[model samples]
Target: MNDADAQMIARRVREELARRRLSRQALADMARVSISTLEKALSGRRAFTLATVIRLEQALGVPLQKIPAASPADPLVASPDNLGAYSQNAVRWLEGRYLTLRPSFGTPGDIFAYVTIIQWDAEQGCLVFSEAERLDSSFSQSGKVSLPHLSGHIYLVTNVEGQYRLAVLGRPTIQGALYGILTTLMVGHGSQLIPAAAPFVMLRLKAETEIAFGRIEANHPDYVRYRAELDLVTSDGFAHFPK
Candidate 1:
């Protein structure tokens, strides 16, 4: 995530904790997280994971989706003559949705989350989700990245002109498959498909641009497929559907 977006999430998390009159200790206890870990999450010192975000939401009884994100890059500020490389206009776009499900393989278990991007929507004359990627059984040691854990999934999204571009990040996995499906679906009838692979979640699009940002659906179709598979792995109340 960009600094602008990271800061926004951090501020939102802090505000919610305060609004509910929840002290750091109470929050950590309620979320089953350590105080220091909660501090990093709330301060944006660490990458915001869906696992931690959900815990906070449940504790605060609020949704992370409600958090306000910075608007797409501003044109006037994007020109090299007017701004530096670190400006908002130079930042990329990426939206993530995390779902915590039951343990399927190991002691640490797995944390599920879908990472999606804004692919150009030709028919709609804008950008829409090309796909929602999934990390079904990715393990997170002790529910933190400080120790042994998986990279999960990562990709890029860019806002060029009035449209946002999608960049599938490398090789095929459930994540890439989802993006591929979304790219095809969003451009179903008439649309230009520009398939590019980017390193990390960085957008190399032009400076100033705006696009509607977000995933097309609350739970993408692949999620449904994952749920069916998960049912056989974990019994009863362990598995869940996003609400």
Candidate 2:
């Protein structure tokens, strides 16, 4: 979205919040967001979330459909296994490891998320690495330096603590492609992917390559079974949905 669009959305939210005599804190509480997050939305520093927008609309009895926000139907989802080959290569490079892949999840706003895990093998005594670096290498080979088709920026969570403390890394790319990947994944899964309802997935690895385990809630079903296999068949070992 452009600056003007963001400004309009923020103004609408602020106006509605004020018309309802709802304090910023109250509105944030109702929307289940941090006060700072609400501030960012109101200040036009960040795009309003789908849930937050809906809540604001309902709270003020306004019609959100009239807004110029990006449509949820804007095809952004993509195959979860599109990156399967790259993921496989990373997993193999760090051989002495037990690995797990998660299923892809799609959200209403055309966002897709998936996760994988790598565990150190007791016999190898080596640290296993499966990070964005490997994925970038693969993308370079495919002649695509960035994956904007997946989303403007992909957020990676490095650590989590009781849902309150989490370390996240955001990688920016082409918004259209990112949205396409997310939308396609949702089509393949036929499910609503929301952070509130369905939490984002994350890969688990051991500190110092000790050992790791994949969480059941963090993986896609197809990924665990045939992700690597599917990667082998993707056109040139990479799937380009945006193109």
Candidate 3:
């Protein structure tokens, strides 16, 4: 951290402590940082490490410092240094429309299908996704993609204010199919929304291949093929879920 960052963080920490009526020891315990280390940093005896700052931010539930803008050398790459720094060229292959499939929440033996378009948003300088061809159009999603190298998985994260919905997908297969798990809220009976999770797959849109979207029930000609694709999610080790 630079001098400016250190000063801002120290001021924010002190302000938070006073506002929350929390003692220094309480904050140290909450952030899991040693008292001596936090004391030294606060007193300007030593600089705070990046890890320490991250922990403090998490504990405070607020960002104490500014996230540096993208570097000039890689100006168009994703920013804030947390989304794996994937450049447009590196993720170019992922830019396209996908036939998204998952289990239906209202129908026990049926599937839900939709079209998801992933494309580079030049204005935002990052990849983004938006859904189409959904029966429940209002609930259709749009979000940012996170490709973290730590797990070699792709995360489609949609955050509305503080509410978040996520899809954690494995790397694409030889045929460019992405299998994963989707976590979101399902509108249940009587207009109730409940937390829901299910296996998900995104098949690359191909020329000459026909795909039907929304509420694909058994006996729909595409049912067998789609069912087999959903089965591959676990059989192929794309994602795992406890029963």
Candidate 4:
């Protein structure tokens, strides 16, 4: 890779590590490499080989290509026209219904699969999503949009409650599935917002027929079936999805 590309990769790696709250030693173990080797790569003292890159990608639950390249300018702080362009691009890619795989609160080894609908909010100039079945409910919801940066485009989403659940969505893979890391700002011991992060993925469910949304509850049989079809992976296995 060129120097610019190498720098970009380093930035992406550091960001991913921070987002997932992974220690260098932990990532080295997961990647089956020594901590020193990983450090050298990160520090640009050693170039990353294809094999090493693949291993790191697998370990981090992120594709190397999904990590954006460094940008020449800050996209979010640009002119109104530039911002509009970024928002439009984001809306086009993200405005749709998705079956989200969320960590199940009651079951430690399972995921909660539910339908969510994303619509464009003209006033907000961003895309908003809510539980497809519970459109009128008071539960917190998330919105997503495209943000421009040196690396091209990044998708950011947030759900507001007492704090916020923010996630950065990666590029879709060959199977059209999306994966990314989630971080939440929560009230801590001192009534301050502390951030915690985890990885997640969302798969698009075929919408040939209208889906029944609001009727499915946590204890419902359909909910059980949905969970059954979804293969629950450990936090480190966030990027893996069953076809």
Candidate 5:
């Protein structure tokens, strides 16, 4: 979204919050987004992504970004549909610690490397994923895994009151490589964030000894190998991007 549209949405959100007599912290908790991101966007230092706006709309029980400022879908629903309804047995194969790689949003010519552990949530009766070993641990994500049968795709979805970040990947290759795309806000020069997206690769890790985590620069030994893996997201048809 451009600056103007983003500012307009921010204005609407402020109005809705005030009209509802809601505190920012309460809304942030309900939406499950970091307080920092919410403050930045609301203060106009950053732009709101559609996912975030939708989340906020859902949380506030009203529409903000979309004009007519009205929605046919009921906004008063207590919560989103349970995305983790798949059986444990059906998703057991996906549990593991994966070396997650994608281009860095803050740095050019570098790859962001981290660990994503997918595990079975016995209490929730479904699969969930959490990130770790990230340089910015404060922004690490954890959310439910949605495995839809007909589409044969897996989704990692995180929703914050007015923000969301998602990744969709296909079945793992024989080599245990899962390729896909991620869409989320890119932290820019300052707190400013615009809608940004890039391909991501998730490789099942064999041992903690082999891979390194954090920002992998050109000089890092793992850079060459990690860069090649992310390339496969589009080159090998695992996902597509429109030019």
Candidate 6:
């Protein structure tokens, strides 16, 4: 890696460490690397090997590739006019960790709660999103905003299972909440791709809320509440109806 790449990795490491409240020693222990080695990489005194990078990724629960490097050519920062394409207020409103609600696999009435993080991707000139359970260090999917005409904002994210999924987050309501639809590509027995969609909602969590790392089991209290909220949205016909 070049010096720029090394610095990018270092910055990402620091961000993750702060977000997860992990100490350098804690990360070194988790990655099975010496404190000195971790220090050297973070200090930019040494570059990380591929194997070491993987270890750090696992320890940090962040995909290093998702972290963009600093570049002056980024249009989002370089051109003021670019901001007019999307609402800065909406951008600020949408960026953060949200507790997302979706239908449970094979259980129509059941709902699953997953944590999703959204951030501005300056290089891509769009919002980048990732979803994961608290216990899972790796993101289950990565998505980016898709532009053009739309009644609401649309995101095209690729699931870890290699399926393409689309999420449409509607404009902020008076209540300051975003309701949307989640569409997944379903493969039929004949190898045809069918779009199956479900109505869902996302509520931004308070920064102080303790985020659990493991999957939210059906028996969890949040599951019932999430299902109830989603059911309400579907019943009220508030979710985006994709034509």
Error of 5 at 49 (Å): 49
Candidate 4 lDDT over residue span 48-163, tens digit each: 77667776655554445433442655333211333323333323445577766555433454444556666666555455566554333555465555444333323555545544
Query: What TM-score do all the candidates reach, one by one?
Result: 0.27, 0.26, 0.68, 0.45, 0.64, 0.53
Best by TM-score: 3
Q: How do the residues 142-202 of candidate 5 rate in per-residue lDDT, one tens digit apiece?
A: 9878765345567898877858899999766646678999999977767888999899889
* Worst lDDT 10-window in candidate 3: 72-81
Error of 2 at 72 (Å): 22
Which of candidates 3 and 6 reaches a greater lDDT?
Answer: 3
Candidate 6 local lDDT, 119-224, one digit each (tens)? 8776666667888773435436676654332233445456456656777765444344567788776555587877788886777778787644344566776666
Clashes of each: 1, 26, 0, 3, 6, 3
lDDT of each: 0.37, 0.35, 0.82, 0.56, 0.77, 0.64
Candidate closer to the true structure by TM-score (higher is better), 4 or 5: 5
The residue pairs in collision within model 6 are 134-213, 135-213, 135-214
Clashing pairs in 5: 31-161, 52-162, 52-163, 52-164, 56-161, 56-162
Q: What is the lDDT of candidate 5?
A: 0.77
lDDT of 5 at 4: 85
Query: Whole-model lDDT, candidate 3?
Result: 0.82
Question: For candidate 4, what is the lDDT?
Answer: 0.56
Query: Alpha-carbon error at 25 in model 2, in Å?
Result: 0.7
Greater lDDT among 4 and 5 belongs to 5
Q: Which residue pairs overlap in candidate 3's backbone?
A: none
